[model samples]
Structures are given as structure tokens and as C-alpha cells.
Target: MASPVDTPRNSPSPSPEPDNPYPVETVLTVPKFKRGWAKGARMAFFEARVPDYTSARAKGPAQTADYLVAVSNAYCQQFTWWLDPPNEPTASDLAKTDDELDPAELQLKAAKILRLRRASRNLLDRLSNSAPAISKMTPAQIKRDPVSSLISAIANGKTHVPRARTAYQLWSKSQFNKDIKTDVDQSVIDNGVDAKSGRIRLVTGSTQQAFQNLPASERRVWELQADAEKAANQEARGLQKKDGVIPAMPLDPTATQDMLDALVHKIDPLLQGISKLTNGNAHFYWAGPEPRRGGQINVISMHAGVDRMPIPCGFMEAGGSEGVARRRTVEAAIGDFALSCYDPKVQAARTLPKIAPCSAPPSFLRYRPTTWDAGNTESPSAHSQPSTDNGLISPPDVSLPGNPTTSSNQSPSATTSKKSSKKRKSNTDAAAPPAKRHATGVRTNTNDEDQTSDDEPEETPWQVDDDGSGEDEPANSQPRRSGTRTSMRISTKTLPPQHDPLDDITNTVHMSSSDKLPSPEIPDNVAGAQLTDDDTMNEGLDTLNAPTTPATASTPVSTAPFLSNPTIPADLPKYLTHVLPKFETLAEPAWQDVTKSFVKYEVSRKFDDVRLQTGNRPAAAVQWSRLRRPLITPDKLPREMPQTVKLAAEAFWRWWRHLQPSWRNVNASANALGDIDRNITEEDWERLDASGANGLVNVMGYLWLWGMKVGVSGEGCQDWEAALRDVQWALEKMTAATNV
Candidate 1:
């Protein structure tokens, strides 16, 4: 017997779409300055859209290069020539008119700064006034949930790709898809997708929850239903029996590495990241809302589970609001544009405690708050940067409106934990000591410093422990793991129901009622995680059943190039096995099936049926949510660096080798595992529980974490809160399966 799957688990309990979109989130307002700003950068990234970028069009990419460099410089300087002191007028200082410079010299920076300025008045604006409600996401969910990372096949190639399609059926298995055999893990994939939700669910909690949700917990005796269905689903290659091609099972992963490379890397990046498709304006590599402030000059396109590119922003010109028309004129001439919703810099700047106008900081604070807290430590009056509670280990809110948690309100579903840290010392720099200490465990260091003060008791006095500030709201709770998400167009509908969905714009954890209450003190890098490898990387799952790899040997992902690039992206939290907590690895026999009878794996639609009020999302977001996991087909771990992605693959193998209890890991759908629990009987459940669930949830956590780091953030994949939430959800599902 198998388990149940083939759709999102335990969701679709509808009330009205929660009207209030904006949720409360921690906002770190920083004063940009010269030296220490970049440490915990003050930069704000916006998932926004802008209109005409004619000025930038006049400049173009070739011409945009020189200006882009100038913008980076201008922000750092205080110039009287410009209306604002912080605004660097150096780029334009070189030329009185746009034509004075060589068209070939233009860079994206100049255009990015100039274009976004045209959209905004001042660089320092508070874009996201309210925090948006966002739940944690698994790597799989982020990759598959593309409501914003939409890019269309530009017929004319002049304007931005239009949003022609809305919904797509995404597979949950795609996120952790390690095997590169190409054909969608026909058996495994079919296990999760639901033709109705346009999403695939393989090993899900929905069915189990159906029984678990009964008012009488004792009444919930689980049964093995979906697992057999999936076993039947995985019965054949492509799983095409007399039914012709099944609606759920699609023959995927057939394309050569070359085709994938072309589509995943070249085309996707250029179209969304560097392309001038959106009226010469910049667009996010993935998808989301518009900027709260300054606009985007460069286009960013991101793919799930893989790669990312950085996004740059510029300050709005003084009296920017009044000069909107003129700004557009200039932007259009030079082809400069800003990203939507990013204008938060503008809003935040306005709200930020005005320090000496001369002492502003640099931008990196948007993604990392540790530095922001450091800054506050140095400045007694650090109003710009706010406070957070680090003691509680609150997880992202996974409960959607209709889907009451298993215990209902009896137990809060999520628990918050401090950021995970590798056992190794800070490889980047020495951590700051805690400034003050409390018996209850509260500590504070400067939130305005170059480095975050470690509050971990074991560290030092300079460290500051924080209880994350952001909290999820009741109405528009971030979309839960098992539910569908909604996205609307910005040009026309950007401001429809409310503001951004995430409450705190920056990354921070939220504590819940049920979470283990922390002492007054909390520290950074506290998740004492460990890594265990599966023996199969060097040994064997089966010589015949090996993993797959990219076919085109021409291009390989090199460690050298990645390390050299200042922007070398780290694989998401998944690969960061150094810090995983309570993790006992799940293993598999080395998949020896090198039979790369490649199938072109496009994110197949489970329900080729109608996509309606059913959580219709933007195509851009859908595109960004799907991560590509090319199967590894290697020999004795290639002695030399290959042309394709090497380091990540190597690290993956090394980690695989560390599995604690070598598992002949089957690519079993979640449903199958559930059946093993159910049919086995209560005694079996008890035995399995005692023997250990192998920390399956922990495995999912690492995978989700790795996924986030892989892509340049803002590519719709690097939401830390989402990653944490997904891990918790996975844990709950796994725990339930083991107990039943």
C-alpha cells in the first residue's frame, strides 16, 4: 500500500480573501553614512514595477554602464551642486547632456539611479509603511509559487512581457528534486499535484489532517489510501498506461543540459534581469509588488532552486514628486527606470530619525538586520533602526484562515528560533560583544554598528540578544505551505485591497505563544545544527540506479568563477549543513541509474483544466518559484573541475556521504511514508517513533535553506521567514506521519 498525495494538503478553507493586505513587520530605518553603512546594509530591495523608461531607452545598456558606476559613487558623496548633499552628481558631472558620453560606455547603474529617481522625489523615502503578512515558505514552495516572477515570450521584444497567463500547476517535489533523470519523478511528482489547485502534492498532511481535525483527536485513526494510488502512479516510466498520458504524470527532464542552460540561465536572466523589456524600466529577477520608493534601473530574472543576480537602487531626486514629468522625460531619454514597491527607501528615509544630514549609511541593511542592530549600539539615539526579540524561537505562521492547526488554537503551530550558525567561528569577522545583560536574558548592543554583536552567552559581552520584532496577523496570514497564494498586477491593481503583504520588510523571526519562551537573553547563530552524510555518494544505493547530470559537457558550474565573483551566490540554507539542529540524515543507496534518457522537464500542469478563482498568480512569480535540480551523473567525483555546476554538486555529495544512518533512500512520495506509518498499526507507529523519524523535517529545512541562498535574493526565492516557516510545516507533517 502507498500513501495519499497529488495536491496541497489541508487548505482552501475560504472566508473572504483577507481584506487587509499589509501586516506588521520589523522595519529597520537606517541613516546611510560613509564607512560603516555597508556592513548591515541600509539598502531596501523592492519587488516593484514602473512605467516608461524612455530616458534610459535613450541611453540603453551599452550607455547605461558608465552611469551605473557613477550612481554607486554619487550616493556616498556630499555634493552642494546637487539639491541634496548625499546625492552624488558625479556621473552627470562628466556630461552636461546625455549625448556627451559614449553610448558604448553606458552601464545599468546610471540608468538605474536616474530612472528610479524619476519615479521618486528623494532617495530616502519609507516605502513600506506597514508590514506585509508573509508566512514562511519551503524552498519547494518559493520555487513553485510564481505569482510575481513572470516573464512572457516578448513577441515584439520592445515592451515588457505582458501577463497573458495567470495560473500554473506547480509540483512540490520540484524544490528538493535532486535526481536529474529528467522525467518528472513520474511516480513521486504525481503523488502531490492536484488538478484542481493547479499544484501537485506527493507527501502531504492534507489527508491526515482531515482525520486529525476531528473534534475528537482519538477518533482520528489514519488509513493508507493515497500511498497505493501513487504506487500505482509510479508503476511505469512516464506512468502512461491505458489512460494515455495521465493528467498528473508528465514526461519531463528530457532536455539536454544545453537546452536547460539556454532557458534557465541565458534567456531567463536577460529577459528578466538585464533586458529592457519593461519599457526600459527595471524589473525584479522574479516577481512581487512595486517599490515603496526609488525605482529599478536593471531588470532581474530569478529561477527557483538555482541562481540569482543582484539588484541596485538609486535615491530619488530632491523635490522628486514635483518633478515627476521631467524625471520621466530624463529617464526615458536615458532608459533609466526603478522597480516598484522598492520606493520604501524613499518612505523609510522620510520616517528615519534625521541624524546629522551629513552622516547617512550605505545600503546593505535591507536583507540582514544584524548589522542594523550593531549600528544602533554605536549610536545611543538609533531611532532609525528598531528593536526585535531574539529570545523566542517563533516559527513562521503556517495556519491559513480555513486550515486550523492540528491542535487548533490549543497550541500555536509555529515556534521561533534564532538564525542557525555553523559550529565554526564567524568566518567573516569577529562578532561584537553584548553591551548590556539581563537575568531574564535581554541584551542590547548597538544596532547601528558594522557588525552584529553576538548575544550568545558563550560568545562575549559585545553581543546583543534580540527577540524578533515582526509578528504575523490574523486576517491575511502569509500563505500557508499547503494553501494557494494570490497575486494581482501592479500597473492597474497594485494598490487594490491594501499595501504589501509582508509586515516587516527586512528579514526577522517572529515568536508565537506556544514557542519555548526564551530567557531575557537570545543570541545569534544559536541553532546548533549538525550535518550527516549518506554513504551513497562514494558507496552505493545501487550501481544501476545512479543520479543524473547535465548532458552538455561544454559548460559547467565552476567554483572558481563563483568565488571570484563578489556576488558569488551561496546555495540556499539547504546546503548550509554546518548549523542544522537535531538533524539525523535520511539516506539513499547511490542511485546508479545513470540512464539519463533525458525528458524535457517543463513545470508540467497537473490540472490542464481551467485555472480560475483558484489562486491565479502572476506568470513572473510562477516562473521564479520553480528551481532546477539537474541530476548528478559523476564518476569517482570528477578529478578535475567540470564545465557545469561543480562546487554545489560536490558539496551535495560530501553532505550525502555524512548521513548518520545510511538510508536506502527511496524517492518515496510523502503519501507513501504516511502509509508505512498507518498500515503498520499503532504498535508499529510507537516503534517507528522510538527508532526515530530520522529528523525528516530537518532534512527539509536544510533543503529549503539551500534553495534561498542559491538565487540572488529578490529573485523570489530568498525569503528567510518563508524558509523557516516551511521547515516547521514539514516537521509537523513528518511528525504526524510518524505518530500515526
Candidate 2:
């Protein structure tokens, strides 16, 4: 219901009143917006007509927002999903105002930059057409927010990722080299090296002396690693040498802030593309010592999944204290990566699934102890074996000459009575093996036991004693060579109680006067104790086998002592009827050296034994000679060896001269000596592979023999003696072609 005054007021136009009224309220009709008006058919037609206008509207701040969401989310995922918090930059890292950075923090920044680079690239690629507004955004600007700041607190941290990695690698590598160099120094220090040359000295003469000496493996590995580290260090040193690049050593902990900053600035871009293939997850480490016992800390995305644990790479012998020694011992015990997968036996018998080619080796394919979580205990140290020091075995007394003959009954000093005492003194002074012979070059034989003898006490020509009763001769005195020979007390055994020579002579006279001393006892203990009945008969049968020593200085001695097993027995004439015409050839000094060396080494004794065992076959005699040569000639003796001892030296010389071409390639030329009944076939060669064939064995044997003949003997070459001792080792590993 309308009021009367209101009724008139209610009309479309209202009138004014004297006291209380105003003008009329108007209602105007306005054009309406259509349903879905902003997105209407007319607007759609306009948008379609002008594609650029629609495109401009679509590419607005909303695209920027989407990009921020995508890039931010990607980086966040990278940080949260990939890196555990411990590996991330911490409050301490953010507080580090100095240019000097914690390696971990630098690593974190590098990882973050990697994430940003990856995310930004991905975003730019995806938003190329519709989200052109994304071009306005940069990871540099976006990383400043609290969320992005969690990954990298410092501004421009994203830019440093690559350089940080390179610097880190360089720093770590430099440190590794330093440690390795220290280890090398320690090795040389603990195990003394030669003063004149740098080769390791033989400190002990145990049967297993090879282990006591610098192990060949350790030497080889250290040499290689040291060379590499030295090269890298030199390169870094070269870089540091650059003017204004660094004010001090690059590795100095307190290097100038500017230098450090410059370093970071210089290095960042170089490593930017390091893991482009692996998405920044392809990192390596070289860790050791406390906190990094498993080796240098690093993270890499392994094939199975992400890895964030310390990885053990190669074993490094700290070679330091008990603790360090324990660590090295442990590393050696369980850490050597013997790739069993490649072994034929293991491959044939394995029940496990095959390893993936893309994944890590078996040594690194297992889970490692992680440092990220709390309550994790450090790995326990390995239990160490008890150690002891035995008398340090060195080479057999090099100061004294070996017995001239294998006959233990005869004193070698007696034979040298006429020689100048100066010759003996010269020989004694030159005790050490000559440098040319002591070369520690690699050899085919690696077995340690055979390198030196511990089985029997070495047979010395005579024992030295300082019984005060016997007056010592002055250094310049014309001392008997025999008396001087026993003056060097080489063995560690305590000397027997001193005796008065007058008392001994009086006692000897009393004993001799009381009873004729039991027909000059022929003790069985002496070498060449007595000629066996068979040996005597053999000698008597070969009446022309006796050796004749020439008076020339080149002759080893004026006469070959009656060593029991001489190739030409004492009773046998030197000129054999089998080859009597060749007797003139035996006059050479080379033959004298060969004959003396053979007698000294007891080779003729061994030759007779082999000849008897292998049958009276003349071919067997030649085979025995081949076997004996290497045994006798590790340090090649000055003389050339005769082909066989069964024949007279002249006869063998004649045969050797005739058969030079046939025996040139020792292995290829000689027929198989031991087990070969037929010619080797192609299949035998294939099966043998690099293990060595009949020909190889023969050639090595021949060369070994030749080396003994020509290699410097006496104290001139210790390596030769070592080689001689290793004959059994060679025979064990490289036997005659058998089971063919």
C-alpha cells in the first residue's frame, strides 16, 4: 500500500515539499551483460579475429606464477628428494661470512646450482609457446626466497655449482697426493732403500723374505699412483704460479679471502657441465682417516637408486702408528677387489644373478655405512695379528768369497796360499752385489719363498772366530788369504769361549802322542764325503776324463780340486776318446770360468743325479744341462756354459759350435725334454694360451741358463743369486709341456 503523500512521491518522478521533501528517485534501464559475458560469443569472435590479442592475454603474470610454481617445485624436489639434510648447508654454513668455504657447504651449493640449472632449462623448454612471461623470471632471483634459500643461503650460489665441484676435486686431489707422498716417504724410511740407488734393500733373508722386502705389488702400485699425483700437483702448482691468481699456496687453509673468492670465481663455470649426462649425480670420492674412513665422502645416483654414503675406493696404507697400521691392515684384508665375476671357475659355478654392466663393480655394489643419520656407530677397527722381529736376514755374507769347490773336506783357503793377500782384501772389500746386478727390475717369477734360502744353513767356506789367543794380523800385514777369509764374523751366533792356542797345541800333541788319531777320520758330514763305488767304477772306466788346469792367470785355479762329482771324474782323463780331436778347444779362459763355476755350484753333482734318474739316454743329459744352466747362472757368470757335462768339455764345445742354428730359439729348436712323446698340435697351443708352451719353457730355461753363464757372478750381482734360488719357483709354475 502506497501513502497519499507517498503515493505522489511514489510516481516515477517525485515532487519537492516545502519543509521535508527532495527531488524524485529515478530508475534507469541499463543494457545487461550476457551469460558468461566476459567469455561471450562476440568476444570469442573478436579474440578469434585478432589472435595476437588473445595470445597477449593468455601470456600474462599467471604464466609467470605457473613457472615459479614449476621451477620452485622442481628445485625443492631436487633438494628434498636427493640430498639428505646433513649434506645440505647448515646454519654454520650460512653464518660463514668469510670467502673460505667449508667443502661440504661448497658441495651443497654446487648441487643446488645443478638443480636450478636443470629446473630452469626444463621450465624454459616447456613454457616456450604459451608461457612467454616465464622469460622474465630467473633462478637467480627466484632462489632468494626462504623456500629456495633452504638450498643455498648465499646470493648467486646457483652460479657456483660447477666451479665449486672443480675446485673441490682439485683440493681433494691435492690432499690425496700429499697423503700418498707421505706414505711413499714412510715406505722408504721404514724400509731402508739403497743410498747410491733408490732400490729397496733386502733387510731379511727368511725363506719368505719377499714379503719382508717391499712387496712388488706395493712398489708398482705406489710408483704409478705417486707419478699421477705428482703430475696433478705440478699442474695445480703451475696454476698457482699464475700472477695475482693466488697470494699463497692454493691449499693453504688460511689463504687470503680475495684469493679464495677469485678461485671460486675462476672455477665455477668449468664444472657446470660435469654431470650433464648424470644429472649432477656422477661424483667420485677418495676418502680415508677418521670421519672419512670409508674413503672421501661423496654422493652418486647408483643404478639401483640414490647413494649418499661414504664409499671405499682403493686401499691406502697409512703406514703410520698402531692405529693407522691397523687401518691399513684392515684395508688390505677385506678391501682388495678380486673381480671373481671374471674368473672362469666362479662364473661357471655362480648361482646368483649376473651383474648388470651399467652398475658398479662387485666391490662397490653393496650398501655402505651412512653418516647422515644419528645413532649410527663408527665401524670398528680390525683385529691386528701379533707381530715379531726375527734376526733381520740379509743376503748371505757377501764380504766373504764362497768355497771354490763343493768338497767340504778341503779348505778353500789352502788353494789360494800363493795368491797375493791384496786380491783377497779386494774381494772382501767389494762384498755387496754390484749395482748392475742389483737392478730391481720386474721379473717373471713373483714367488717370495724361492727368492732366498732358509731351508739349510748356507755352507760358508769357513767360520770366523775371535779367540784372543791368536794374534790379529795388521791390516797391512801379508796375512794368509785363508786366515783373512774367516775374519769377517757374519753370523749372529754368539762366539764360543776363547781358547789359548798354546794349550790346544799341547793337548793336540798329547792326544797324538797317546794314540795315532784313529786313521784321520773321514767324516761323512763333509761335502763330497767319499766317492761311491759306482762313481769310482764309472771314473775308472773313463780313464781319459781327468781335467788339466793351465798355469795362466785366466785359469780359475791351477788345478780343479777333486770334487767328487766332476763331469770328468779325477781318475778319468780330460781327453775323451769320444771327442779326442776337440781337446785343443778346451784351452779358452771361458771354459776355465765355466768349469770352476760348475764345480762351485755342485752342478756336476746334480747333473749326474739327473742323468741317472732320467735314464742313460744321451738326450736326457742335454735336458739336464738345460735345467742346470738357469740354476747356476742367475747373475750370469763370465764364462760360457758347456752344452752337457756328460761329454768332455771339448766335445760339448764342438757339438755347440755345430748346432748353433738348431738351438738358436731354445724353445722352438729343442725337442720336449720331459714328457713330450709327440709333436705339439694346434689345440695344445690354444689351450695353453699365455700360460707358456713347451717351447716357451725351453726358451726361458735356456735364457735363464745363459744369463747365469754371462750375468755377473760373485758379489757383482745379487739379483743373479736371487734368480738362481728361484729355479724351483720357475719349474713349479712353468713345467715342461705336460698333460698335452
Candidate 3:
């Protein structure tokens, strides 16, 4: 997904709209930052409605050059300031601003702004004059050109271009390789192989073999050293460490001349792949400082094609953990983007399949019984039996609601006999104990013989009893006649109720007495078989009228109102306790006044500390005495203020009250009545003289009190308490200071 920062709010159209009066005016908006510019820029340049190459070419070289210069200037202005403002400019000073400013500062700022414009013009002229030759030249030819590199740096912030020569230098001078050479030379010397006497060859014969057969412990040490070196190298390359593992280089070989040559050979194909993907319009370059941290290689476009603005295609990390699973390079990142554009199947293959909200019904519900055997017309037994295939009671054969019986399945006489059989079976089941009743199947009773009687109306299957049981048999239900065959048949359409209707019917049967039948055990596999039509209809109605759960004590609630208990803390100072409850209902304007007064009180305290440290120096003593009056006058305060400021003010009051005894003791020592002031240092006095002590103390006290009230703990509360302690210690030390 693309972020809002990367997408352009408004894009330009190639041709004017039918209602638009002007046709030539075209406007494009680009983001000021480059963090999410890759994906956004690609959408703006390629996906947006813009003119084709033929239309752009018709504008001619002169118009194109002017457009390039305008875009380049706009890009440069975001990061660069063209003019320096004069310092301390008054009405009179503004008239002579040039004379007041340093000449060197003016020249440096002007040169940078002009440099970008000049390079852009130079690039246009170079391309226009050598159009045919430039078209034939490879990507290497354009990259090596000075103009291409200069414009790329200005437009897309591409600073570093990787080279095979640089890679070779990095490997040759690496500390790990130097250590390996040292170990090989030391091994040869320890083995009594005299190289100076020419007794044994040192370069490749015995010494090389000894280096290859290094011990397991020594090899492990080298591997650890290599990992450390790789981490440091990646840090220098501006890549972040992932999962505590530094990204590995494309080719990492042990310290050997042969391995080093192979490492250089592997890099050539990677560089070529990057060049081929970008062609000549853009270059794959590292976009950051020379020794930058936390950055990646980006494919920066030069705006040489149909694109009006210089945009990056995408970026990729330089290295990953060494092995079969290496991180993607710049070539792969660009290739993926290109393939997604050309191949529709690639995107289709990556998309996840959609899933249904609810799962399919169980296999038992899908079971449809075959037609009954006509040759042997034996009636079903007294109770319905469970099917061997699935652990569910076989449903009785009956016509479903809104579904008429077909001639092929039922004859006129056969239909009447089935209805009579169901009516008799329902009465027998109702009289039987609930323990014997099957809980997984729904039973429906129908009687055509009862329909003719006007006095007792025929009962419908949808009717519910007075006790809310839908299983109540008709009031005129009859017992089964002897030798009557009852063929049990289940309708494949309707499902059973969630709670057994038989339980409710059994409870209705014994309503007068407290005794009830025990529920029959159901098989674990067919537990869901009891979801009948009546339960489903009731559930649908309940869903429409269901009430939502209300908020409970365990749920998190907002504390924005700043309401708290009326009772004040016992440790709180008596002078401020009366005003503590007012903070809960404080207004915004009065809270600002309290903050200002607290700042003044803190400033006054600093001056008083300076007076004690200077041994009653007249200048310091006068300043302290002047500012001491009206320092947080409690009676003059407003009726209400913010709770945070109130807590902070109260803390300052308590802290001052606590320091009173120490202040008196320090004052006595300074008057030559004690030796406490003798231990004070000049550094302690200097620290006390620093400003902003008032704001620091106020903030720390507020945080400490707020954390306690809100039940904040862990490192967060500990940090605030630690800061408060440091402030208290500093103030105590200031009180004990003597003349310097």
C-alpha cells in the first residue's frame, strides 16, 4: 500500500478539459521529501494521465530545456537557501544590509543556487548536440560522464556509484585479510621453515598448505572476527542491522588471492544487471552522506525521458546475512517493479484467495435417504434408530413446509397412512420418558381425518404450546392402533431445533410435579444436529432485538476530565491543601497564570542560592532580596487551575518547607557558626548558577505526582522519581555552598 505522503494530491492532464479555457497551462506537484518518493513518483510519472513521447517531442528542444531548468530550481530550493538574511536588522540597518553581511557567506550561498541551474543547462546542451552519439552509447558511457553525475546529485540526491575497483580496494585493505596474512607468516616461522635461507618456499608451498589446514578453534575465531568486520563495514555503508545481524556483502571469501579474484568477478554481473535495468535515463546510486548510516541504494531518474520531474523507481538494501538467503539488490527491486507492470499473471499469482464468512453444514445434514422399499412394507419400530453411516438418528419421511408431495414418491393412500403413522408416533413419543427420546431429530405430526371436524380446528406444524414448546401434539391426538405399520421418514430440507423440543414437551407433561425426565446423551460427532427450523426462526428474531453489553469496571475509561478524590494526601503541606480540590474543575486561562507564577518563584530561588554561595556579596544579595517579594502568594492565587500545575506548585511548596531546616543550618555555617560550608566546591556553585532550573523542577514534580495518581510504574515512573531526587540533591548542595 502507498502512503498519503508519497501520492500527489493533484496531477496534470495531457490535454485541456472541455470546460477549461486554457489548454497550454500544465501544473505538477511533487513532495518536498524523498522518504516515500519512490512509489509515489512512479505513480505520478507512469500511471497518471500524461502526454506520449510524440506529443512531448513536438514541443522542441528550447521549450524542453526551459522546463528542465524550472523543475531543477524547484527541487534545489527545498534543501538549499539562496540568500542569507542580515543579522539584527533595524529600520536603518535594513537599508545597508549588504555592507553589514560577511562577503564570504553571501558568495557561498549564491554559488550553490547557481551551480544547480548551470549544470542542468549544461546537461541539456550536451544531450542536444550529441543526440545520435549519446543514443548509441551504453549506460557505462553516460554514468562515467561528469554532467550526468552532477545533475543526478542535484535532482535525485544520488551521491555514490559503486565500482569494481572500489570493491577490490575494500577487500585488499580489510583488517580481516591482514590478520590472516599475519597468522600464515607466524605459522611458517614457528615450523622452522627458513625462508631467508631458501630452505623452503614461503609463498605457496608449505606455508599456504598450513594456512588452509588451520585448527577448528582458530577457524571459529576467524569467523567471529569476520562477522564483526562485516557489521562495521555495513554501518559505514549506511545499512541498518536487522535482527541483531548485519547485512552480508554479495561475495564474502576467505583471505586468499584466488578467493579475492573470484569476489571481484561476482560483482561485475551485479553492476551490469543494475545498469541494464535503469538503462541510461536513471542510475542506481547510494543516496546519503559519504559515511552515512541507515540508508539504501536508490534508482534515481534523470528526467531525460517523458517524465517532467526527476523521480526514483525504488530502493534496495546493499547486503544481507551471508548464505543462500541474501537480501535483494537494486537490480532485483527495479526488475520486480518492471515485471509487475508488464505481466498481469504475476499480480494475480500474488493475490490471496477470498474466504467465506460461514463454514458449510455438517455431512449428516447433506445425507438424503433413498426411496422406501415397496415389496416389503414393514412399519418402523417403536423408537427411531441411529444410522450406522453417521452417528445421527434417521429422520422420519414427511413432506416439508411449502413442498408438495410428488406422485413418484407417494400415492394418495400411502400419504394418508404416513400422516396417520406420524400422528400416532408423536403421541407415543410424548408419553415415553425423555431419556428414551432422540435429541437430534425433529418430529412433525399431520392428520387429514381431524381436518373435517369444525369444533376442534386442525393443528398446524408451526403452532407453539402455551408453555413455549413447539412439540405439543394436537389436543385431539389419538393412540396408535394394534398391528399398524409406522414407516419413519425424515425430510431432507428442514434441520432440528438447537435445544431439544422434546425436553420442553417433557417438562410440560410433568408441569404439576417437580420431577422431570433426564436428557438423552448425544454423540460428539453429531452434536450440531439439533439446529431445527423453529430454533433458527427464534434466533433470527432475537438477533434483531438483542441488547449490547454495557461497559464494565474492567474496561479502560478516559481520564481527560482530571477528576479525583476530594481528600488531599496527608503528606501534602497544610498551606496548599485547601486549594487542591479546585484543580479538578480548573479553567484553561487561570492555569497559564499559575505556570507563570511558578516560573517566577523558581527564578527567585536560584538568585537566593547565588547569594548564599557568594558569602553575602552585595550584588547577589540585592538581586535576591529584590525578587523574593510576592513569590507565590497563596491568598492572591485564582480559585482554579490545571491539576498538573497544581500538583507541581504543591510539590515546590513541600520541597521549600523541607529545605527550611537545611537553609538555616547552612546560613549559620556561612556566618562562621559551623563547618558545613567548608566542604562546598566552586564547580557546585557554577552548576547552581545555570538557568532553567525552575522549568526542570516544575516538569519533574508534575510527572512524578501524575504517575502516582494514574498508577504508572515500571521504568517510566522510576525515571521521573530519579530526576526528582537529582533536583533535590542539587538544591541541598546549593544551600550548603560557601563563598568562592
Model 3 off-target regions past 4 Å?
1-147, 150-557, 560-720, 725-740
State the TM-score for model 2: 0.14
Q: Please give the CA lDDT of all the candidate structures.
A: 0.23, 0.25, 0.27
Q: By TM-score, how accurate is candidate 3? A: 0.17
Query: How do the residues 1-740 of candidate 1 rate in per-residue lDDT, one tens digit apiece?
Result: 11111111111322222331111122332223332222112232110101111112233432222222223333323221122222234544633433443454333323333333322312222221211111222344335542212221111111121122111112223323343222333544566555224333432333233334545533422122234333544563233333232122221122111122223232333433343343333322321111211121222232211123142111111111111122222222122123223354442332212321111111111112222233345666432322223221111112211112222111110111122211122222235532322222222222212233333223321123232212212222333344231111112221113212122112211221111111111011111110101001222213122112101111111222212234322321211111111011112111001000000000011111221111111111221111111111223122222222323232223222222121323231211122232222222222111111112222332333333233323342323233334333333333455335
Ranking by lDDT: 3, 2, 1
| lDDT of residue 309 for candidate 1 | 19
Q: Over the full model, what C-alpha lDDT does candidate 1 score relative to the true structure? A: 0.23
Supply candidate 3's per-residue lDDT for 579.
Answer: 22
Whole-model alpha-carbon lDDT for candidate 3: 0.27
Looking at model 3, residue 575 earns an lDDT score of 15
- The model with the greatest lDDT is 3
Q: Which stretches of candidate 1 lie over 4 Å from their true place?
A: 1-252, 256-261, 271-472, 475-740
For model 2, how does the per-residue alpha-carbon lDDT over 345-449 read when each residue is reduced to its tens digit? 332232222421111222111111111011112212111111001101111100101111122211112111222112132232244423221111111111212
